[model samples]
Target: MRFTIGKLAKATDVLVTTIRYYESIGLLDEPDRSESGQRLYTEDAVERLAFIRHARDLGFPVETIRELIALQVDPGQDCERVDEIARHQLGEVQRRIAQLKSLETELKRMLSSCEAGKIASCSVLAALGHHEGCLHDEHGGQEVLAKPPSI
Candidate 1:
């Protein structure tokens, strides 16, 4: 059955803009257009979009997802590269978890030191004011006081 872009988005539970982005990035194939110019998708598109969605949900980067898709074209290819990609992603997840745990510890320390006093005497504020008060020197190399881009 053919599906319009809206129907495809609804079936995949993905945003229409996201679908268009995937197409633009070569992650998803462009759909056929009717004489009146409506996009027409097929079951193949539905399945491919689902795969992409699942990969994205798992925090797979788009370039990595592209590599995975390229590997899919070879039916007789060995599965080593797929295994490596999954393992690398797992490592990244582990690293983020560790960073979060450190942040949690720091936040708890700051809160615990709070004496229910005024903002001037607040330990949390003190920590924010003085980065030396932080238990960790760095949070995954993130800035101690990051500056926002100029609007």
Candidate 2:
């Protein structure tokens, strides 16, 4: 059964633009076009898109996903490469977790330093003004900001 791009997107829970981008980048195969020029997709396309979506949800990079797809094309190949990719992704996740923990620790320390006094005397402000006050020096480079504590 052939499906249009919209149907494929709905089936795979991927955006139409993402599907197009995947095709443009050779992640997804160029699908057959209908008589009027509408893109036609088969069950294979739907399955491939689902695989890509699941890999993305797991935080696998596009290049890694592409490598994985290539691996899939030859089922007889050993899975050592797949294991290596998974291990690399796991290491990256662990590194991010460590960084996030440091950021959390620093943010908590900063909040505890706030004496609930006037802003002029706020340790939080002073800490923000001077990174030297941070308990975790490595937290400075993270882009994620902790939410303000409740009053």
Candidate 3:
């Protein structure tokens, strides 16, 4: 079945602008237009958009997804290269998970120690005020107070 851009966006749960941008980027194919110039998409587009959205949700970058799609289109390639991509993505996810755990531990320590409701005695406030109290590294500690933590 064919669908309009709005229908495609609604179906995929992707923003209309994102869909257009993907088309513009060569990441997605440009759909045919109706007599009124409204974008018309086929069931194949629906499947492609679903694949793109799923890959994005998996935290795969657009560049990586583009490569994966290219790899998928080629018929003669072995499965080994696909395994390599999965491994690379897995390593990235694991690294991010580790970073998150560290942040979680630090946040738990900071939040648990601070008194929230009191006017003058907040553990968070104290930690923010004292440089040594911050768990960040030397340059990072300075950066966090001036600029918010990356997380």
Candidate 4:
């Protein structure tokens, strides 16, 4: 079935702006325009949008998704490349999990030290003010800790 941009977005559960952005970024191809200039999409667009949504939900970057789309178009390509990308994403996820676990540990330590006094004596505030007071030495020393949102 054919769909307008709105229908496509609704069908794929992706926002219209995001779909337009994807098109601008070359992630989604520009669809044919209707008689009055409205964008028209087909079943293939639905499938492609679904793939893009799923990849994004899995935390795959746009460039990686583009590569995967390229691979999808070329059926004869070796699956090894796809596997490599997935493995890389897995490693990143594992690393983040480890980092979150460390953060959890540090938070617990900070909370445990709190004696329910004023903000001056609050362990959480003290830790925030003085990183050196943290029980975990590696708490804020990593480069990742300084970086903004990655995924």
Cα TM-score per model: 0.91, 0.88, 0.82, 0.88
Of 1 and 3, the candidate ahead on TM-score is: 1
Candidates 1 and 4 compared by lDDT, better number = 1
- Candidate 4 lDDT, 47-130, residue by residue in tens: 999999998877788899999999998898789999999999999778777777788888888888889999777778888888
Lowest summed lDDT window (length 10), candidate 1: 142-151
Q: Which of candidates 1 and 2 is the stronger one according to TM-score?
A: 1
* lDDT of the structure predicted as candidate 4: 0.84
Off by over 4 Å in 1: 141-151
Clashing pairs in 2: none
By lDDT, the better pick of 1 and 3 is 1
Worst 10 residues of 2 by lDDT: 142-151
Candidate 4 TM-score, C-alpha based: 0.88
Against the unseen true structure, what C-alpha lDDT does each candidate score?
0.86, 0.85, 0.78, 0.84
> For model 2, what is the C-alpha lDDT against the true structure?
0.85
Residue lDDT tens for model 2, 10-110: 89888898999999999999999988999999999999999998888777878999999999989998999999999999997787778888887887988
- Candidate 2: residue 101 Cα off by (Å): 0.8
> Could you tell me which residue pairs clash in candidate 1?
none
In model 1, what is the error at residue 61, expressed in angstroms? 0.3
